[model samples]
Target: VNPVDRWDGTPLADAVRAGHRQVVEMLSAAGAELKLDVSQTSVKLCDKAREGSVEGVRLLLDGSADVNAADYDGRTCLHLASATGNLMMTRELLKAKANVNSVDRWGGTPLADAVREGHSSVAKALLEHEARLEFDEVKTSSELCECARQGDINGLTMLLTAGADPNACDYDKRTCLHLAASVGNVAVVKRLLEHKAIVGAKDRWGGTPLADAVREGHEQVSELLLAAGATLDFSAERDARELCESARLGDIEGVKLLLAGKCAVNATDYDGRTCLHLAAATGNLVMAKELVAHGAGVSITDRWGGTPLSDAVHGGHFEVAMELRKHGAELKYSRLKTAGELCELARVGDTNLIRTMLAVGAEVDASDYDGRTCLMVACATGNMHVVQVLLDAKADPSVKDRWGATALADAVREGHAHVAKMLLAVGASIDLEPSEVVSRLCDYAGAGQLEHLELLLNCKADVDAADYDKRTALHVAASAGHLHIVEHLVSRGCRVDAVDRWGGTALSDAQREGFTHVCKFLEGRRQLVVLKRSSSQEQLNLK
Candidate 1:
């Protein structure tokens, strides 16, 4: 008979807990069995070892304890020993022939766990024991790749030398080289190169190692790969799109290298955006200047019929817009007067520059392709100071955007309470449709500013109004797990059972979103008998 009862015994557990090695050994000989149900076992000896108690660990292991046994959480003795830098325990486990590569439930190998815990010595020991690198185990490779992506040369080199498959593609077909290049890990790139790794390997998105390096501004890694004969134009199938993305990312060296390697600088993307257009759209002045200097076409327009100058101004690149204007760029497709000039100035919040533009006859009320006036953009961005300048310049604040949404609507929708207050003070209408008003209230409530929501309510905005999805402020507060906001909304007499367009009540939405507190509050208000009983029982247990 097992001396320890299977269901209700703690002899082995108690001995380990008390750190009584002699008692543990004697009990083991006298037929004390370790519970295989790890939740009840002395396998947690590793936890004691991690806390720097070598004797506690020795008691269990010497008693024929399973050295490779894991805790309830799948954390092995090695994981604990390695994480805590207990080299003696580590050596003992290695002697006991513990599986060096066993991982925890979290996919954390001893080496990875050691590195994470800053135990370099333990990590070195695990490496020497031939702990498998490049964790090909389904649950752990991505994290291991992330380590390589960070250019941990010691870890990377160890993994590579330990027979880790360097070309093992991740779920996205991204090889280790792809990660190294993306992070500009020059040394790791060189090491991978020595292993004869495929230099031009493409990821799931068809992004090559060179493309990733260039896209991320990894110039040194790019040079290294180039010297190793990695194809610069290997992604020629999507060269135009890739180059545009590179320009949009502000990669000057990548732009230069691609251009030098004979990528068509003026090649249009699927959206008809050229390298210059991407540069202009992102406000990359240096890249725009460089593209222009390299003979990139300035006349290319996007699908929306807007040129590079339009992109620059719309994205708030004043200097880039000016540069493009100096290059004779046109805003012919824009409805705004002096579109390039005024939008750029407004974008920078440069009141003085805007005044200069106005003095020189730039149009004050010019609207964009989207029918958005300077004041609308200012209000949308919550740049109240800029809105004041535009307003003083006679820019119409009442002008609606393409959505029939005015500046006040934009401010409220984006939770700019101060801007909304200013707009309301300036005689902006508060009599919006009930649905729109409630949508704005939800936006404020979602940002956790009950004060803003209260202000909207005080302005005579409807509290029970529903948005396009028929979601009221109560629904928004509940879904965001803001218990206080839920309480406030409920206290304000907002309907607790208000259902959305999908026929889901606020209580259902809260439960779906994992908002337990909101669910409890809503359930409490509903007087759900079971929930009330459960709450009472919980309170009694607590007492």
Candidate 2:
């Protein structure tokens, strides 16, 4: 009478599925234990529970069916009832002594599902049953570093109070303390220090929290870190950047301070635009003359190949442009060029103009001094038609720019999967060095660049590749609170338990940072990894 069937369930479960209440009770009384696999269990039980079939559930429970017996996904009837907000079913399951804290495959507890689904009745009842909705599950401990980075003190406090580790470092080897200090969050620093976060912890680049504060010129944060015993090894770089801004704003006094501090008068900003360029562009004749007198080069070209005189002329500062000429700049070289026009057209997806240029014998592979071809420009902008035109005209997709970036790299970096596919079809190289692969993986994962991650995977990059800090792309995605990217990496079989140099796994990092969802996913994957290892050990032992 208790024999199992093809559906992997006993006669009582089959009778329950058939909805024969009399037969179900008859089978229950005849000693049938209600057991089932995924198909018969989660589906049938979920339907019965959601429909408030109290008698059916009671029949199974009274027939000695384990109330806590879960499906393959570890989902008990209680989880389903709580998720669907079926308070009636939840009460029935609870009355049968359901394990309220049972974690499903997705890391959902009955209370968590109840709370997430907004069934306060079920949630309160579960709480009364000794179910603790831990803050890690509720607030997503994966966001702790983000909270600290954003200066969300209340959120940080909640995460810390909920048991997130203060010293938990990210995939980049940076802790929440590092993020707070870098952003000049004095109150966050205080809270982190109170939690005993490592005062002198260094990042992957060996930059301490104090070093970050000092580099960003946050004097207050620097002072706080120093008081908490952090050391600094660099200064004056921020002032150099400030010099360019001061020159543009015509802050002559600030420029004087930078000059007095022996800052390089010719120091260029990130875009290779110097103080002379800014001063000239803003038509600040006094600032321009001061920079020129202090040895600013008028002939130096910026990233766009524009000289200071060119910037002044373009901005209608003819007077400043004339002054720059007097300051050892000779010719007003015309920035207008046919090749420049073609590249510009490609950038804006002007396919007809590009076609006309190509028809008129223009160099299809014409590049600027930076080695940026028209194809590279088109690919970076995801101009698929323009890229196709350039490709048909024999434009080299494999050409690398001055920064070693090819069309494929540019498309991937910008999340242009279609462009990357075209480049790949044309044999554009994905032959990156190990370091390049690691950099791309971490950068792409942290930025949530799914296209870039996919392109890297297509290139056969190692799913478990670690950076210098021993942190994988999975770790980076987890700490960034990017659950989608984290899931993608795990789907590709990344090691969830792969430990970083900070001795933190992806799950631990997510938990530390307040990404409870990421933690949940990683925790489930970790159990699978452990199970596989144990199975392998068993096989080896038998051998």
Best by TM-score: 1
Q: Supply candidate 1's per-residue lDDT for 271.
A: 79
Residues 250-344 of candidate 1 have per-residue lDDT tens digits of 87877777777788888887777788988988989989999999887676777878688777766667787788878788755534556555665
Residue-level lDDT tens digits of model 2 in 363-417:
7776777888888889889989999999999988878888787878778777788
Where does the lowest 10-residue lDDT sum fall in candidate 2?
133-142
RMSD (Cα, Å) for all candidates, in order, is 22.9, 34.2
State how far residue 389 of model 2 sits from its true place (Å): 38
Measured by TM-score, how close is model 2 to the native structure?
0.38
Model 1 steric clash pairs: none
Model 2 residue 103 CA deviation in Å: 6.6
Instruction: For each candidate in the order shown, give its overall lDDT on alpha carbons.
Output: 0.75, 0.76
The TM-scores, one per candidate, come to 0.56, 0.38
